[model samples]
Each structure stands twice: as structure tokens, then as C-alpha cells.
Target: MKNYIFCLLAIVLFSCSPKEQVQTFMTYNLRYNNPNDGENRWEVRKENVADLILNYQPDVFGTQEGLNDQITWLDSVLTNYSYIGVGRDDGKQKGEYCAIFYKTAKYNVIKQSTFWLSKTPEEISVGWDAALERICTYFLLENKETKQRFYVFNAHFDHVGNIARLNSSKLIFSKITEHNPENYPCVLMGDLNLLPETDPILYLSMQMDDSKGLAGESVSGAEGTFNGFKHDKTVTDRIDYIFISKGDAKVKEYKVIDDQVEERYPSDHLPVLVEMEL
Candidate 1:
């Protein structure tokens, strides 16, 4: 009788314990909707981009350099996902967006906002020698199944301004610390426009763990994330990244997807995908 009771209690305890949830995340740069891109124009590559995303179906993803119309088209096509972001130009639908998208059925958004990577984060202005206005979009999300809450920050740093990139890194770190006072799990992903060895990345590495280094043997695909629409296999300038708060999550796999259709690449930059347990 005591054995039976013990077995029943074990079963109950096992059933009641919280289970670890695994989620897939991706960071992609769509290269904006420039008509001068010719065969690589947004209209020409939109379907391929959708197909790639649908094939992987990441639980969450961040995109950079997408115009309002481009974002609208993606929002329409990715029916199961919802996104949060604002244009860098006007805090409205004016310029490029650094948008974050999550699966609507799996997570409920608690709070979301967008802020410029500038001296005046609350206003629409450029900062620190940046060539153009930059922005970061963040979302606090609650997983419906486990009731676990986490934050996701998606950003785009200045490609031309070294000082801007460094300051932007500091600002983003501060913002992350400010928003997550309870030390909830955080994921930061984007097209930072800087290499892995740069000072900005080094600063971010002080507190965050780059998913690529954590994946170990599970890393796959190209070593770099930017293809520049060139078929050269020798390109290895990795500028995109997925970073998670230290010890917050365990990375299961990391991949830099270089999928191309008929020898034509989808975009100028490839997508960085990470699978993690949180």
C-alpha cells in the first residue's frame, strides 16, 4: 500500500513540475524595398523570403531594413505571427523598421515599444555621427503554455558610424537592464552591421552569450550571414547575430541559413537561426 502511494505521489509531482520549453528564433535583414536592386528587388524576392520563413517557422524572429509596405506584406502573409515595431524616420510608417515578430498562438504580448538609438530615444532624431536614424524594438512576451515571461530586443546599428554603434550597444544594454529588473530571460537579435570582433560586439559579449559560440557542435550552414547576392562560398563576413542573456537559456542549435533559389539569393544578407530551451 505504501509503495502504491509513493508511486502515485511521484507521478503527481512529475506531472505538476514545470517543463522546459524550446523555441526557435531568427534574425533576418530583408535589405529594404529598393527598385534599383533589379533582379534582387523586393517584389522579385518576396515569395522566396516567405517560403524560407514558412519552411523554418521560427517561434520568434526579428527583421531589419524592411519598409512599411514590405512589412505589411510580410504581416499579411505570415498569418500566424504578430509583430511590434515603428519606423525609424517618424515613429510611424515612414522609414525602415527593425521589427520583432512572434507566434500569436504561443505567446501573449505583455508590453512592447520602439525607441531610437540616439541621445533622444523618445524622439525621432539621429545620434552620434550616425548616417541615419536608428532604432530598437522590444517586446515583453508571456508564453501561454508555461506562463513564463521573457523579453526580446531587435535592433539595427549604424553601418557608417563607429561611435554610434558603440553608444547604441551601451544604450541597448542599459535598456535591457532597465526593462528586465527581475532578470527574466532576454534575447537580442539583429543586423548590427558590425563584425564579431568589433568593440560593440565585445561590449555586448560581456553580459550576453552569443548563440553561435554556445551551440558547439550543433552549428551549421555558412560561417557568415551576408551573401551580398553573390554565390561565392568564400564570403565569411558575419555581421548578424543572436544573443541571449547569460545563463538564461541553453542553446540547442545555431544556423546561418544560406538558402538560394536557382542560384539567385533571396536577399543581400542571410538569416541567423537559433533553437533554445527557456
Candidate 2:
């Protein structure tokens, strides 16, 4: 029976198409420490992240909960990748920042932009959120060899504002799908802060495919992500996520790696990775 099960697993694994061109991607919330630090530090949590990035080496990475300094630290360590220019924290580029990193050797830079999630979220501005200002940064990229133009938008929704999160989810759909209805593929990833059943996530899923959670593994249930700092094994919520474009793209392999090694657990929230094909 054991031999039979092993044979079954091998057959299943080999049956899947080996799309060599499929890209490996990661999304994380780098944990900019705003609550415990007095010196305005985003690098307080740097060491933990640096180690993880070196291990994953994702072709494209989208990050939320990153400040300018944190981004700088990452930029310094990962020499092969370039960011989407200088990104903004919200509609206005301000105190906080979110960004997309691409492995220059793996893909070519095509286009990039950052937008806010407020009534007036400029690329640079410290707006008043119920808790904090939120922003979404996007990059339109192409494989140097395949020449496929796909988009990646990374964002952080307001932690305290339900209405804002709901509205911002709507904005993403409009700017991405409604505006480019002629088949512009997009990948949306971020620390959305809402569960699958919540209004915000539900609204966004209407336009984009939720690559990490809602499609295959648990088409109807939540896959826990945000594991607390002390009791690392206890998981109760699904906040962080990875999403793919509306057309042609489908998540092939998806996983949430949860293990305590050198303080890297895919980022306070498990770093979700997905392989998608065109």
C-alpha cells in the first residue's frame, strides 16, 4: 500500500505540465516597526527579512508594510534586483512606502506606478487614516525572453478603516479591469487585512482571481496566515494574499510556509508563493 501511494504521488506530480517559463513570486509585509521604536525605524526587523529574501529568490516580489528605510535596506542586500523607481505610500507619496522588486536578470522593467487608498491618497503624503495611510504600487513587466506583459500591484489596506478598505478594493478593480478591459493581465498581492468572507476581499475577488487562497486549496474556506509572534503555531486568520490577473492566468502551485527558523516565517504573515501560466 505504501508503495502504491508513492507511485500514485509520483504519477500525479509528473502529470502536471512543466511550464519552465512559469514565474515564482512572493508577497510579504516586512513589518515596519511603528509601535515599539522611538527612532522611527523600519530596519529594526531587517535581519529577519534579509535572510528570507536570499532563500526565496522570487522572480517578482510585492511587499506591503514597508517604509523608505526598509526598502533601502532590502535594495542594499539584494543587488541583482531593481525596484519600481521610488514608490509612494498612498495616493500621495509620503511617510510610508510600498514597492515591487524584480530580478533584472529574470525579467525586464516595462512600466511602474503607485496609487493611494484614501479620499486623497497622493503618491507622497501623510494622510489621516483611522490608523494609518495606505498605498498600492503596481509594475507592468515583461519577460526578457517570453515578452509577456503582466502587471503586479502591491498594497496595504488601512488597518482600522473598514470603509476605506472596501472602497480601495473597488478602486483596484476599476483601475485594473474596468480601465483595461481589452485583456490586460494583472496580479494583485498584498496584506489586505480582511478575510475571504469579508466585504473588502470579496469585492476585490469579483474582478481579480485570488491566487493564494480562494481558488483551489480551499475554494470556500480560509487558509490561516497571520501567526502571532509568541505562539508561532497558532494561526487563526487569513490576511495576507496573492492574486493573479482576470484572464489566461491560473495559480498552478500555492503554499504558505510556516516554520520558525531564524525569525523568518514568510513575514509575520506567511509569505505566499504562486506559479502562474499564460
Candidate 3:
């Protein structure tokens, strides 16, 4: 009888204990709704985008350059997921959003916030020489099954402003430290608009592990994330990234998904994917 009781207790304890969790994360730049895009307009490419996302079914994902309408459309079609973000223009639905989407059934939001990448991060304002406003959206989420909590940050850096990009990197790291007081396992992904080995990426690499470099398995897919819709094989400029906090988390695989429908690409940028165990 004592042996039976001991076995039952052991089973219960095992069941309640935290289990290692592996999740897929993706970062994509959904080019904003622009009518002048002609063949690659949002309306023409949106279905392909939806299909690709559904096929991969990332547990969590981050998007850049999505406007209010585009975000709403994605939120509607991607029924299994919900997102958190605010437009950079007015802290509402005015401009592009650095949206972070998570599977609704897998996690619950504990806290979420959005801040501009500027000297005055508390308010909505462009910083340095940026031609446009930039922002970062972050969320603290708790896994429904394991009860483990972590943070996710998504951002879009200025394409024209070198100072803005560097400052944005610093600001994001500071914000991560501020928001994650417990130093929870964190994931930062985005269209940073800076090449690898540059100052901004170098700074970020010091603080976090670039998922591509840390993947335990082989990294695969296109060498570059930006295609610019030009079928130029010579174009190899990788700017998109996924960085995880330096912790117990292990990146199992990293991939730059360059999938396209026929000869047409969904967006100007390819999506970067990572499967990690935390």
C-alpha cells in the first residue's frame, strides 16, 4: 500500500512539473498598404501572405510595416491568433505597426506596451534623423500549459537614419531591461534595416544570441531576407533578425523562408523563422 501511494505521488509531481517547451517564432515585414505597388500591392499579395503564415503556423510572430487596415485583416483571417501593437503616428491607428502576434490558446498576456524609439520614448515622436516614426511593441506572456512566462519585442527601425538605427537598438535593449525586471527569457525580432556585422547588430549581439548563429541544427534557406521583388539572384542583403535573450533557451533551428507563389513574392522581405526550446 505504501509503494502504491508513493507511485501515485510521483506521477502527480511529474505531471505538475514544468516541461521543456519548443515554440516556432517568425519575423516578417508586411509592406504597408500602398496602391502604387501595382503588381505587388497589399491586395494582390495578402492571400499568399495568409497562406504562408497558416502553413508554418508559428506559435508567435512579429510583423513590421503593417498599417491599421492590414493588421485588422490579418487579425480577422488568422483566427487562432491575437496581436498587440499601436500605430507609430499617434499611438493609435495612424501609421505602420510593429505588431506581435501570439497563438491565443497557447498563451495569455500578462502585460503589453508600445513605445517610440527616440530620446523621448514615453511619447510618440521621431528621433534623430529618421524620416518616419518608429516604434517597438512588447508583451509579457504566460504559457497556458507550462505556466512559464516570457517576453516578446517587435520593432521596425528607420531605413535612412543610421543614428536612429543605432539609437533604436540601444533604446530597445534598455526597454527590455526595464520591462523584464525578472530577466525572463525574451525574444526580439524585427526588420531592423541594418546589415549583419554593422554597429547596431554588433551591439545587439553582445546582449543576446542571434538565433541564426545559435541554432543547434543547420540553418537553411535564402542568404538574404530582403528580395525587393526583384528576381535578382545577386541581391544578398540580410537585415531581418530574431534574437533571444542569453539564457537556458536553445535554438533548435533557424530558417529564412523564401517561399513564393510562382514567380511572385508575397512581400518585399522574406520571413525569418526559428524553432527554440525554452
Candidate 4:
């Protein structure tokens, strides 16, 4: 009787204890336009996106071009973490939304806010003459130890609006580097829409180091991240990226996930994940 009670107590304690937290991050641009897409819609590829993130096991995730349904769906599926940051697409309540997901067990949230990527920046509305409006999600995350904390900014710039893209890039740079808040580490991830050698990309490098793939590797994973669907197969370009601030933290590894899952492709653009350590 004594041994039986002891064994039961041990099991209870083990079950109640906290699980280990992982240290990693992932970013993806899940394309919008589900309602109009008809047959090839977001619903067809949503589950695969969630599964891809789960496989990499990033402590945080930044996503671009997520609609209301997709965001809600992600929130529903991802119970272990919390997500915030609204999309400033068409109006206050329409168009694509960008967001960040943080692991609850891994980090404590200190502060979180959203900023617009438009001339009329106060409101979450689309920029005039821009292909699409952009909003950046910023999070101040702290470890359980209380001493470790850092900032993460995620955004999606205009696809066709060149002026908007340059303007948005300037805004991002100012937010991250202007104040220089005393050794605060930061990780910036998103679908910038610009390629490796573009003007905006170069400007970003001034503030942080762009995380690239291995030396010998020409590209990270599959060719282009923007797959029209699993069937459309001409992958090209390296637009999506994950970069760490040059001063504070070190970017250990960067990869573009191009796994051939059976259900469908993960997102319109392949997810770019970076593992960093401070």
C-alpha cells in the first residue's frame, strides 16, 4: 500500500511540472485573397503553415499577409502561445494583417504595440498610392530569469508601391536604431518584398546583419517562396529573410523551408527561420 501511494504521487508530480522551452524563431508570409481565390484558396494551405512552424519549433513567429480568418485559425490551433498586432491594409478593419506569436512558457511579455507603414501612420489604414499598407509588430520579450529581454519587429512592405516600400524601410530603420536604448537586443523578420541587393535591403543592413544561408549554397531552400499553389512550380528569387541586429545578438543559422508535404504547400512564400543566441 505504501509503495502504491508513492508511485501514484510521483506520477502526479511529474505530470504537473513545467516543460522545457525552446530557443528559436520563424517567419512566413501566408498570402491573402482566400475569398476571391475560389478553388486555390488559403484554406487549402493553412494547416500546412501551422505544421511547418511546429516542426521548426520557434520560440516566436512573425507572419505577413494573414487575413482575419487565418489569424483566428492560427490563434485557435496555437494554444501554447499568444499573438497580437493588427494589419493596416485597406482600412481600419479590411485587408491583410501582420502578426507575431510568442511562446508563453518560454518568455514573459513586457510590452507589445503596432505601428503603421503609411503617411497617415497613426491609424491602421492603407497608404495612398501603395500596393498594400504595412504595419510592424513590436514585442519586448523577457525570459523567466527576468534579466534577459529583447525586441522583435515584423512587417510586410508594399509589393508594387516602390515609394511606399522605401518609405516603410526608412520608418523601420528609425524605430529600431534611432534611440539606441542601451544594449537592447533585437530580431527583425518579415517579407520585405525586396530582394538581396535592393536599396531597402541595403538600408536594412546598415542597422542589422541580414541572415544568409551557408557559404556554398546558392539559395536557402526551394527557389521562389511564392508558390501560386503546390502545383505551380517555378520557384525563384530570395526575397524573404530573417536578420538579427549587428550589435547585440548573433544569428546562428538561417534557412528557407521547402519541404514537400503531402497535404499542400505551407504558404505563398516559404517560411524563413533564424536561430539566434545572446
- Among all windows of ten consecutive residues in candidate 2, which has the lowest summed lDDT? 85-94
Per-residue CA lDDT of model 2 for 17-101, tens digit only, reads 4553578777877766566543223444466566777776788887776667677778898998888634453233345566788
Between candidates 1 and 3, the TM-score winner:
1
- Candidate 3 wrong stretches, greater than 4 Å: 1-20, 232-235
Q: Rank the candidates by TM-score, best first.
A: 1, 3, 4, 2
lDDT, candidate 4, 191-233, per-residue tens: 8888878888888877687766321243356655666565457
Higher-TM-score candidate among 2 and 4?
Answer: 4
Which pairs clash in model 4? Answer: 224-235, 224-236
TM-score of 4: 0.82
Best TM-score among the predictions, by candidate number: 1
How accurate locally, in lDDT, is each candidate? 0.92, 0.70, 0.92, 0.74
lDDT for each residue of candidate 3 in 1-278, tens digit (9 for 90 to 100):
99999999999997876643889999999999999999899999999999999999999999999999999999999999999999999999999999999999999999999999999998999989998889999999999988999999999999999999999999999999988889799999999998998999999999998998898667998989999988545447899999999974788889999887977779999999999987
Per-residue lDDT, model 3, residue 171, is 94
Backbone clash numbers for all candidates listed: 0, 17, 0, 2
Ranking by lDDT: 1, 3, 4, 2
Q: Model 4 off-target regions past 4 Å?
A: 1-22, 89-93, 178-180, 213-220, 230-234
Assess the local accuracy of residue 235 in candidate 4 as a C-alpha lDDT between 0 and 100: 68
